[model samples]
Target: MWSRSDAPRIMIVRLSAIGDSILTLPVLNALRDHFPHARLSWLIADYCAPIVRGHESLDELVEVNRGWLKSPRTIKQVRRRLHDMRLDVTIDVQGLAKSALPAWLSGAKRRIGFSRADREGREFSTWLNNELVHPSALHVVDRNLGLLKPLGIDNPTVRFDVPEHPSEIKAASDFIESRTLRQGFVVLNINAAWLSKRWTMERFAQVAKYLADRYGLASVLPWGNEREREDAERVAAKVPSHAMVLPKFSLTQLGSLFRRARLFVGSDTGPLHLASAVGTRCIGLYGRAVDRSGVYGPQGIVICHNHTSSDDAMRRNKDNDAMRLISVDEVCQAC
Candidate 1:
């Protein structure tokens, strides 16, 4: 292990989904808090780089294109980059093969990672690290913070401040102006990457209509892909004309839109997590996954339930079914 006085250059690896990446920001913040003088860099998937770009706590953001990693030319590029930087402490927060390889190849004097028993990475990957942190059953936020335990850094209440951009502010303003939604609006994201996790289109329509009729709040539906756009349109068809569909937005633009929204409602997806991260009042729907490990909801009205049968619950654990059984009325009531 390197001495704290060595002033080591640190590299953190967490090439995961957007929400997972966002959830890791607190760890990054805490690392910065503990080692105020360390030159910190991050290795993240290409898609997630934008979220942390220009972050004040991070000294540099390295983009790892997964598609390129599959090619020899790309591997050479990555090797060259790592070779040139020569990190001192490489922390693998993703705890997976994809994230492990980069940290292992970085030639860092000391590497730290979560243990396989923690379900963060495979057993062999632990061998690549100089230090292995076997995490206990805790929230993912805390699990990530546990990596710093060996370094004598124990701050747990780290906060994430997502950077704001002028372009995004303009985009959000343009969207609001073009739509003429002058009154305060509720932003509802109706899409998820997985089909099993998405609520039915009819269910979304019912929720949107209820929010409009009962609350007199205009609903804005933001969709990413074609299928999601179709779903958004279907939901919009059932609500008032003032309830409109938003076009695809970049990460910064989405952040801007989220900031302007009074409340947000959506599935347990990246955008939903994005809303929560931005401190929006969020009501999330989760039917196929566990929210305790990754999803965050603000105080007062975050709704989650389980719908699985006894056998399925036994297989997945009743605690994992927190979001599966939440009904429309339950969520609406929470809202």
Candidate 2:
């Protein structure tokens, strides 16, 4: 437990995944609000740091390359950097060995982390963190907020102050203007990081056609890789006049784009959560039951019907059978 220092030094550790990192924004902002004079830092990997890079509440952005814990040189640098910061508290929001390493290395007394059940690394991260929190909240976002209980903040006003750079905002504006999406368009993120979460491109095309015909809204499909691009092209082929396949967009540009979007249709990926964070209505198609991990806000409409809710192990499986269960008519009805 922190001894109630006025200018407490804190470092929040959530190292990977665009979706989880976006969800952690509310934690950052709430911490900043409560401890106004505190020097707040976030430990994140370089790959996903772009998502929360320029957040107003963050005092420092401690970045590490992938697999930094294995590299002696990188470990030394991180140790030195964190040692200099003199973090009073370390919050391991990401409950894994890799995320726990920073807290263990930081030398902070109050290394807050989730309980054994919530955490993936029961043997490693559990012992590294001294302050244990057993989260009772249903949603992952609220479960994260529950960690703030040890800090005297309960029921904090949830906020995701997703930073939008001027250049990226301008770029998003230019693209929307050029595409003539001012009349209103729906962002169709047809790709999912996990294969199990992905729906068929043909089904996606049907939803795109419905949006165009029923609401007169265009569909913009964004892709991350070549395979996804090819899949997007196939979806676009069906609704040529209504759907437009977008070229590669940077993470920041996508954030800006979601802010101007009317609705977002995708699986439970980063883009869906990002769109939801930016106040865009999202129709999130889930492979598992609609549990706490579904889109955070009321604006999100999730479509899912599984025997049980999803966990980390279930989410990583190589089966699209659950995804196939979601019909195009279900998505169209949600639209």
Candidate 3:
């Protein structure tokens, strides 16, 4: 029912989680392609905004601090800001009470979201949207794109237009130059946000050592926080000859690193998704998400323990038996 002559003020709402935010990039791409003349805005968390801050396809960004919901005063501030935007259409790809509440408050004429059966917090959020879409069994990227059907967008392409910051690229270049790292060095990320998803430090060392000895490749370990830095240091200590632990970097700097790397080896996490988006070949280790099926891009491969059952894969803990069952040789061979 929408026409090319109409220019609706559009707002997309997908907030938090590094990986999920990156996956929502395709939805932005589709809307940009179809409604080039419209004013398109993204309501994202403050932390993940840098990933797409300078993207060419985006018109505006609304950053919501993580703790804003805790204070009534701040909540009113956010509500007032969103209401002032006068959005004609609002798409809630996040599909939660937190996201739904804001979408509802925006007072958009065409509010779209996943159906009650397809989305979580169904009982709480079912009434927030004027239009509901029943999604198919597809990758989260495509599932997010499905929300565009009501706006007359279909069969959209998967594209990640992650912007490059010149300063960040210079930092990445300087780091590589200082280390004397050659082209085609592998990036090994040792931490996952979830405890059940991390492969052991010893196994990571073994893989790094093997890559060094067999393929003459150096391995760099990039950590996000103090705990990850400690783990990366332990791994680097074992293979001191070929492994280097990187200092903490911003999101854009990590993207710069991934763009220069020959390949990426990591658990199912935000960095792995970032690597795939930047056109790096990736070997993702899996436990509960073993059959990551369509989640990866063309050059990305997933390795998992053959014996793990589907129902038992996603348990939460520091030491996952299924993840531990995967051998270093399996990961090395896949790389």
Candidate 4:
């Protein structure tokens, strides 16, 4: 962050959620490029740590669970660790009250964060960061990179160093052989963290059939929980010739599988971003969220049906009629 000879201690504070965690990888890559000698670290949530766990760019990965601040013992432990790091700067990429508190706790002289114009960077975060950046880009990845202008870095090369472990590779290969999916397949991630973002099974079935008949690509459905598992099975049962379901696996393993798939068709969810990060062909389905949060690269094809909905109206936790607007014919044509 200073002289070429100096190796500044920098930490990135991104609290939680899967998709956002994947998007932050580009910022980490940029920072590493700018300061080759810098000791770079990331403060991530426990759930999302695996996404960036073994990245070549990161020197440290400090993971904490939700509501850790509420516990006096946990706070003491985290603060002690932050103090020992002797951080030169802490960037608040999360831009929330929870994310802001970590930056304040870091006690870094050059605490950088986004301006209030960014919806996420409101009054609470503004009070914490010592330096504020007014981002010019619309995409979240570009916006995160905009924070690096203070360090004399601009328009840095966009890259995601998603780890491909040996064990995960073997697991993915074994699954592929077991399922007889050697003829190449496309991932249909029908489940989403937001109900509003999830397209109907019938629509997914139609897309699955089209992929099978038109492209000779079978559909692979991956689920997170038991409820999703049942839904995936139901879809597979209906489209037995075209669709199949993947068993329980970790995020890392899923990345390995996605790397081998012909295409990824999913809503604005973690799996879609993960697929994008691993350099897979992604057809991102958007409704509640904007296309700006779509897949990161040229290989991505965004099918957005959102017309008049506002960000405040399409909350992730609530169900909306927006996703239904994305018809089967539209997805088939995109395919």
TM-score list, all predictions = 0.89, 0.96, 0.94, 0.96
Model 4 Cα shift for residue 46 (angstroms): 0.4
Instruction: Tell me the lDDT of model 4 at 105.
Output: 92
For candidate 1, the per-residue lDDT at 172 reads: 96
Q: For candidate 1, lDDT tens digit of each residue in 128-153? A: 88788988745677788889888788
Ranked by TM-score, the better of candidates 3 and 4 is 4
Give me the overall lDDT of model 2.
Answer: 0.88
Please give, for residues 1-335, the per-residue lDDT of candidate 4 as tens digits.
Answer: 48656799999999778999999999899988888899999998899999999899999999999879899899889988998899999999888778888888987889899888847586599899989999678788998899999988899999998998999999999999998889899999999867778889988988899999999889999999999999999999889999998989899999999999999999888999999999999998887557358678899998876644356434755674788888898888877
- Model 2 TM-score is 0.96
Model 1's number of clashes is 9
List lDDT for all candidates, in order: 0.76, 0.88, 0.83, 0.88
Model 2 per-residue lDDT tens digits across residues 155-264: 99899989999999999889999998899999999998788889998888888989999999999999988998998999999889989998789988999998888899
Query: For candidate 3, what is the lDDT?
Result: 0.83
Q: For residues 1-335, what per-residue lDDT tens digits would candidate 3 score against the true structure?
A: 76766678899898877888888888898998888788889898899898879888888899989987798998888889889999999999888777888888888888898887533335556688888888774567878888999989998877897888889889889988988885569999999877778889999999999999988899999998899999999999999998999988998899999999988999878898899888899998877644422346788888876434343224554466767888988888887
Candidate 2 residue-wise lDDT at 105: 94
After the best TM-score superposition of candidate 3, give how far the Cα of residue 255 lies from its true spot, in angstroms: 0.5
